[model samples]
Target: MKISQISVFLENKNGRLAEVTRILAENNISLKAASIADTSDFGILRIICDQTEKARQLMHDHLFTTRVNDVIAVRLDDRPGSLAAIMTLFEQNRVNVEYLYTTHIGQEQRSAVVFKVEDVERGLSILRQNGMETVKGF
Candidate 1:
């Protein structure tokens, strides 16, 4: 299954990140997981939230550059080599992971990772064949 990730293009400056968070907070949107990659001039803030479409629309209304991307979320065991095992499967399948972020879910001692890959369907297939569980929602 594919998860919706919201990516916001932010200018690299003081309080820009805070501003984004403030907007989301004002709109009552909660972030489940988030990651940011930055350069000298700008940054891309990627987030998974309970209210994805609403968050995207709010960002748009505020004139923040945004886009929705499809990413795969997998439930991983919270132990050494769990991620390495998954990476090996991806390597064997020729799936390129563009980027990824992880979050701990509940009290199950499991980690959830959101992966942005070159091919979503192929990656999902490979993960499934390897007996990995794909997380569907928050």
Candidate 2:
């Protein structure tokens, strides 16, 4: 399964991140998972929210440059080697992971990993054939 993730490009300055969070909160967009890759000048803020299209519109209205990407999330055991095993699977399948981030599924003690891979559908299929559970929603 693939999830819609919005990425906002922002300046790497103090309060820039806070400002985005505040805007989303003020607009009632709840973040399910998020990640930020920063450089000296700017940063790419990737966000998975309940209302994806609404969030994108809000970001655009705020004058922030943004884009939507399709990512895959997999639920796995929260323990050592769990991540390694997944990577191994990807390697065997010749799938390249451009980037990844994790979120916890509380109570169940499972870890939900969001992956940006070259082939989203292939990644999902590989995880599925290996008995991995793919996250369908936030």
Candidate 3:
């Protein structure tokens, strides 16, 4: 229903992002998807990787502040009004998105959009009842 996304709390300074990537690279963890939200002082690095638990432990061992959050990943047609259709469902169900980020996969014909909703279970159930497909796996 949902996937574990690695959220890293990092200072908003030069080389900080690179350091995190280096750590993951050294451990051979492949990043499948990622997003970042930042402020003046800090940033949250939301990442989806093949080895989530291992990535979490590695970050912890390296003294980096991180957490694992359940985020919903969905597949959507890569065309106009695709997203609008999904949001319409949430609006109908009164589900607050809170925050969301997306990435594209495949070519222009088909693609996927991953989102982080406020409530995982409720969101999943709503999506299911509405016949929305959820992306799975690490």
Candidate 4:
């Protein structure tokens, strides 16, 4: 129900993002999924990879500021309204979603949503009780 994610703080400048990707790629780290949110000065790069610990260490060794956080991932149908239904469920259950990102495509006709909620355990339980399948490290 919980997976490790590395959040890399990056400067908003040319080659910054590419440099990060290069560092990971050169080290043979494969990113399963990634999201980036930036402002005027910096950005937060969230990445999901199998070698999470190694990724974090590598980022640190490169002098990049990084933090590891636990997040929940759930599998959902690819059809329309699937996301809305889950959002409705979360809303009804009062689960505060900090942030969320989804995989472009998943096994067959499914998609995976990775999220950080205020109460991870509570949110996970709600998802499980609703018969939602949770994804493990990927």
Q: Write the per-residue lDDT of candidate 1 for residues 1-138, one digit (tens) a residue.
A: 899999999998999899999999999998888999988899999999889989999999999999998999999876899889888889888899999889876656678988999999999988888789998887
Ranking by lDDT: 2, 1, 4, 3
What lDDT tens digits, residue by residue, belong to model 2 across residues 1-138? 899999999898899899999999999998989999988899999999999999999999989999998999988786789889999999999999999999866546667999999999889899999998888886
Pick by TM-score: which candidate is best?
1
Model 4 scores what on Cα lDDT? 0.88
Local accuracy of candidate 4 as per-residue lDDT tens digits, 3-39: 8889999998899899999999999998888999889
Who wins the lDDT comparison? 2
**Candidate 3 lDDT over residue span 44-97, tens digit each:** 999989899999999999899999988888888767998898899889988788
Q: Who is ahead in lDDT, 2 or 3?
A: 2
Q: How close is candidate 2 to the true structure, as a TM-score?
A: 0.94
- The lDDT values for all models are 0.90, 0.91, 0.85, 0.88
State the lDDT at 43 in candidate 1.
96
TM-score of 3: 0.92
Q: Name the regions of candidate 3 deviating beyond 4 angstroms.
A: 105-110
RMSD of 1: 1.1
